[model samples]
Target: MGPKGPKVIHVGYTPAHVEQVFFPHAEVVGDLGLSLARLARAG
Candidate 1:
């Protein structure tokens, strides 16, 4: 990938929505959870 190319990244958040508000990217492919008590589920 080039400097301007799109990249895939992995983010693990016990409270999912926390970082989501700061992430400007519309494409999110990862677990969804409000808390760590629940299991890790993909989006």
Candidate 2:
């Protein structure tokens, strides 16, 4: 992996503290099913 990599999408129950420390710029989606559906459609 280089500077540019696949987009990181974090779904469900991600607290702000954890998110800030770990998933900085990740796309945080609350609904797991909805997010999966969207990803499937996009693919």
Candidate 3:
């Protein structure tokens, strides 16, 4: 478990793989952006 909750399993893939898998979803843009923003804030 992570700080907030249970962590997601990435399953046999890297960043590029997951990005490609979610490419067709419109929410991907905002989701990825939020993820990057969170990382930036954490750093």
Candidate 4:
């Protein structure tokens, strides 16, 4: 976790694998570009 809390977006085929390796509360997505774009727009 960072100063502002968890800010990681793990993009992968297996969400379980990401949770095990990276962050358990990470925002797992199938499409990296689309997800990032959406976040960018929202922010």
Question: How displaced is residue 21 in candidate 3, in Å?
Answer: 18
Q: Which stretches of candidate 3 lie over 4 Å from their true place?
A: 1-30
Clashing pairs in 4: none
Error of 1 at 9 (Å): 3.7
For all candidates in order, the CA lDDT equals 0.39, 0.57, 0.42, 0.61
The better-scoring model by TM-score among 2 and 3 is: 2
**Model 1: residue 26 alpha-carbon error in angstroms:** 17
Q: Which consecutive 10 residues in model 4 have the weakest lDDT in total?
A: 12-21
State the displacement of the C-alpha of residue 10, model 4, in Å, after optimal TM-score superposition: 3.4
lDDT of 1 by residue, 1-43 (tens): 3445565343453323525334323333345354323433432
Sliding window of 10 residues with minimal summed lDDT for model 2: 15-24
**TM-score for each model:** 0.19, 0.43, 0.31, 0.44
Tell me the lDDT of candidate 4: 0.61
Q: Ranking by lDDT, best first?
A: 4, 2, 3, 1
lDDT of 3 by residue, 1-43 (tens): 3345544533222342445233322122236566667657977
Using lDDT as the measure, the top candidate is: 4
- Which is the leading candidate under TM-score? 4
- Better candidate number, 2 or 4, judged by TM-score: 4
